[model samples]
Target chain A: MVSKTEETQLNRLENQVDNGGGGAWEYLCLVRKLKVRRSEKVLKHGLSILNDPKKRSALGPEEWTLYEQVAIAAMDCQCLDVAKDCIKVLQKKFPESKRVGRLEGMLLEAKGSWAEAEKAYSSLLEDNPLDQVIQKRRVAMAKAQGNISGAIECLNKYLEIFMADHDAWRELAEIYVSLQMYKQAAFCYEELILSQPTVPLYHLAYADVLYTLGGLENLQTAKKYYASTIDLTGGKNTRALLGICLCTSAIAQLSKGRNKEDKESPELQSLAATALEKDYKQRASDKLGLLTSALRSLKI
Target chain B: MGLGFIIGVFGVLILSHAAYSTIQYRGLLKIMEEEFSGPPMNVVLELLLGFVFCIWAALTVPGKFLSIHPDSEENRIVSLSANLDFMIFNHRAKAFPLEIDMKLKH
Candidate 1:
């Protein structure tokens, strides 16, 4: 993660490149390396280079990669003609590339010609059924056509083959959440947590799902996960702090008629509240009063 | 450059000076035809000081190693995932008049 200073520097470079300044090639490389989405700017700047004979040739062997990048970016920006043009160049350059073939299938999918796209993808898959990207495209195509169940089924199949893929798990979990299938979503999150326990996003998402389930046991588990999220993020995440307070309040409400020993502790809530207040004081002093009143309403 | 960098540079200069002084002292001893005693204590001190300064500079120049996956405001993960291969924000329906229907039962 870039600090504020580095982030500003990147923004400045983006603006300069956007205005047709130099470093367009360098900026595009940076975007790809960092996996940041800058499709509109990439389409514009990438076309500028591709459309120029001298500048395009100056890239030498890197020219084909630039073509692929522009093609993908153009597809994103709804410039099908530009995408077709770039893909045509790539196809001419490498006639038998499976990668280029995948691009063709993608272009057809983008054009909404489902039958032709299905045939293209099927033929490509026959060559290499282990292609992860093609399988994901199938799920994406199902989703694009508003077939959520089909998408989920495709994703589950993909997971059976590639269980280690975090993105597929995340997508499946999100689809299950949308369907309000909390148990399935929780299982997906469990898979995610098992795969990469350090990623705070999955922890936070799992906590949210458990909280939504809202049973006595689920709430207790949700509180633990939320605390783990806070620990993973070094206590800077405000939502996790609020989750602690909320879980404590709910536990208190549920435990009123229970034995004293069965009641959950509350000191963790007070500590979370203090940390939240300190964070607010440091970042938004004027909103401290509001935060105090909100915490007071939570009755901790 | 900060003070540590200046000290590093200074340390390099001193190391070079120590090497030069050793060369010059050897030349002098050969000219005077005297037995080469251990050259001078000052050269060893200069080498030690330069070593310390260079180490300090090496540690100070680049600063600390930060966590690249921070989810704070400065470096929040804007996109859910890269998921570039599956991005379906726009399609032929928006770009041009549709010739075929995608919503047809498959």
Candidate 2:
């Protein structure tokens, strides 16, 4: 049913494949199209060309491009196993290339080789120590494997490499907080605040850790850090919240003093009074209610 | 006599500043205790000043007492203006939240 000209075009394409100049990807594409079109002759020709061992051996840069092409074609054809095998071959051939490793890692991840992907990412990180993408990918891979500790450890390692990376610090802090590792989280938050003295939430985070640690001395530091947050905010709306936190933390620290039955110093009482008066209206209703309860219990 | 007087004046000024810090710290402590219900102002003030005084004394004490020669490296690191590059290296291991708190907007 096909025209002579169409048949000749097919023959020429097959002959092109036979010459081994077009690379693996080119042949894969032709074969895939022929399979879709149900052209048996073209498909047979493509398969024959691709399976040639001599063609595989001659793969240089052009061949690597061909390998990627063939792998992608295999993926497109839903032959994921074939694609993976092709990538493995490429990995062996180009062991030193980051691109090859990354591609292999992606393929492994696609195939659900979570642990292998993590190892590949780890190896990549050794070469590109501050590669944020790899760092994130490594965390994701660890977490996917249900290795929460592993995920945390990987990020901690990343933090060591890129210590000033606030995002890494923040991520570590969040993870610690989630695990109820308050002391460690607080230390991380402190580093964050010291690194970026302007961020108010880092102060809040530090204060949260102090509260969780449950001590008067920690409470005092929390109050001071909150004040620093407020001062840094310079009358921003957030400053009002920070100021309230500062007051509340101060109040908590003050309550600890009552354990000694020491009469409240007048100046200390005045400052608390002033803070209470200033922040009362602005304080969140829930927080204010909690504050009232604390005040009653402490008899402040 | 003139040189001695100048030296005496310098010493007095340093002592006066230290005394002022002490008094201020004590006042803050009293405020903290009465207002927040905490420790004596003097104790709080003393604790706060302890580190400051140590650092101050360490830096200002003449070469005779545990002398540390001033180094350019320390000076370069603590420039008056905020140096972004230096800050990056100094705080490399520390991560601060990039989410700027809306409440902190100046």
- Candidates' DockQ values? 0.14, 0.01
| lDDT, model 2, position A45 | 37
Per-residue lDDT tens digits for candidate 1, residues A121-213, read 999899899999999988988888889999999999998999898888888898899999999999999999998776777888999999999
Which pairs of residues have clashing backbones in candidate 1?
A: A1-B68
Model 2 Cα lDDT, one tens digit per residue, B1-106: 4444455455556556656766676688778874435445665565455545555555455434431322122211111111111111112111332221111000
Where does candidate 2 stray beyond 4 Å?
A1-116, A119-132, A235-299, B1-106
Say which candidate scores most in lDDT.
1
Model 1 RMSD, rounded to 1 decimal:
6.7
lDDT of 2 by residue, A164-231 (tens): 87766777787789899999899899888889765555776687677667666676566566555445
Q: What lDDT does the true structure give each of the candidates?
A: 0.81, 0.55
